[model samples]
Target: MSKVVLITGGSSGIGKAIGDYLSSRNYTVYGTSRNPDTIQNSLFPLLKMDVCNLESIESAISELIEATGKIDVLINNAGVGITGPIEETPTEEMKKAFDTNLYGPINVIKTVLPYMRSQKRGHIINITSIAGYMGLPYRGIYSATKSALEITIEAMRMETLQFGIKMTNVAPGDFATNIAAGRYHAPVLENSPYKEAYSSTLKMMNEHVDHGEDPSKMAKVVHQIIENENPKIHYKVGAPMQKFSIVLKRILPDKVYERMLLKHYGLK
Candidate 1:
């Protein structure tokens, strides 16, 4: 039987890579991007969906279900990032990040759950971040958003096990994706209070992004987990730097970890 996969924020970056990878493997792929014109792939059915909008999410899911009759997998990869100190981050900006990164997935999960429950089988893959596990300066909002998603996804994994729903949280440290340059910085430039601070931190983050793993690598991992008979709850896709960071967080003392993060970002 052919599995049907629905991917959110599939217009670009990691989401787009995942969609292409699964589609290549013969899965019926439905991708939703907020901006439809940006989608060059007509082969995979594309719909316009802003994760912040509940109605749009519902409508897109309903349309997909109507056409396919069932969706076997949902990749909640739509998210946004905000770079600034938490105290300096605007209220609306924080809300925007959370809506896109956290609540957005919640809305999609709600819409997809009913259909999956009826079928008694489904897989939900959330594209979270290493920031979900570790905190760094100037990325407070983004970290918090992913942290919220991490906690929610973990709980969902436990709660939905009995219903035959599998939830996997894929945490990518940094990727050579347009997220930092395109998604986060663009928004910050328009409404930035600490323009210099935001720019410096964003520049540093983008430099890391350029040095990070390729999106295709993560796509391959996603394909593996989906095809696997037994899927793990978490998959970390990142460089040695990311792995080291995770280990440091686990082993280092609290103040030591804080100092390391601060020094690396020149916050110290």
Candidate 2:
């Protein structure tokens, strides 16, 4: 039998692309959405699961395991985006973003570990973002969530090794997906001092996503990672310039890195 793979947020966007690509290559792919009925034309089965809900996650994984006997890989791609000035954004909104982007994956990872452990081998791929590498204007919450998830994945890399479970974070650069349309815009009051800056910055970032790289490119990169006998702990897939930014951040001074981000986002 082909290896079984489970992908969260596979209803669309990068998750959908990966689901399609992997299944076509003969991997027994299973994609999950909050409402499986909405998932159409998928090459593999659609499982109803909301990463934010523990019950939902448990039910879905249990069903997958019952039928497949084991889960060989899991792609934690379910996440939401929240944007606004960090100070103006309500605490509750940021919490919700964290719940979905960070906590949701944690819940899923924990649930799947026992299965992966008993089997003696499994791969857990966390779909992180380039935003995790740097704080972006108006997208501070999104960045924080992804950044936290990456840190957690790093810890799991060491913790899960003895069980033969490998955890890796895939930080994909800007990608054209439905994320822009679904992003929550934090409330910015009219009298807020950051109004003008917030407006311009939000627009700039959203458009960048609108014209981002194709999702299929990232899917191929993910495929390679899955096939590798031993994948690295972290992989950034996207434009050379975006990948270079990570390198620059590591070598450059703090002020220099901030300036580059400002200029790129038209905030300078």
Candidate 3:
């Protein structure tokens, strides 16, 4: 029998690419989205799920397990991003991001663990980002959410090992996707003291994403993780420079690393 894989935010971009790739490879793929109708044309079935809502997350998982018997893999790929100075970013926007990017994955895992425990075998893949390693200038809140998720996922792996559940956080670098269309941006450019700085950084950031890695590349990484009996605790998917940044974060002095980031984004 094919392994049943459940991926969140699969309506488009990275999630969609993963679902399609896995389905083609004969994995029993199911994706969750806010609107299943919108992705009816997709290769896999999509369950209606607003990951930020516990009731909705619970309902989606219950429905999936009821029909499929078990979810062999859970990919926590649903997330949103935000940008602005930490001081000036609106509280509501940050809350919205934390709800979706961090809390959503936490709640979904809580809901699914019972089934995985019963089966004594499962893999939970949390899709984070390289920015999580070191917070970005304009994207501080967004990076914080990912960093927090990475830390949480670390503990989850240790706790669930007894149940033979494998867990890992995949930190993707800038990947070409439609995330910009859904991003929650701050209104800092018009009246903020850092208006010029924000503009320059924003342009650089957007261009970087425009030329980022292919989303399909991350899908391949997912496939490899699924096939490997013991995958690494964290996987960073991107070009050499992007992946190596994580290493730089580990080895560089705080002041030097900070300077590098500032210079890279033209914030200096």
Evaluate model 1: give its TM-score: 0.92
Ranking by TM-score: 3, 2, 1
Task: Summarize candidate 1's per-residue lDDT along 67-127 as a digit string, tens digits.
Answer: 9999999999988877776766678888888999999998899889999999999999999
| Model 2, span 132-187: residue lDDT tens | 99888888889999999999989978998999999999999999999988878976
lDDT string for model 3 (62-108, tens) is 99998899999999999998998888888999999999999999999
In lDDT terms, how accurate is model 1? Answer: 0.85
Instruction: List TM-score per model, in order.
Output: 0.92, 0.97, 0.98
Off by over 4 Å in 1: 185-199
Residue pairs clashing, model 1: none
What's the residue-level lDDT of 203 in candidate 3?
78
Worst 10 residues of 3 by lDDT: 180-189
Order of candidate numbers by lDDT, starting with the best: 3, 2, 1
Pairs of residues at least 3 apart in sequence or in different chains that clash in candidate 2 = none
- Measured on C-alpha atoms, candidate 2 has an lDDT of 0.91
Query: Count of backbone clashes for each model?
Result: 0, 0, 0
RMSD of each: 2.6, 1.1, 0.9
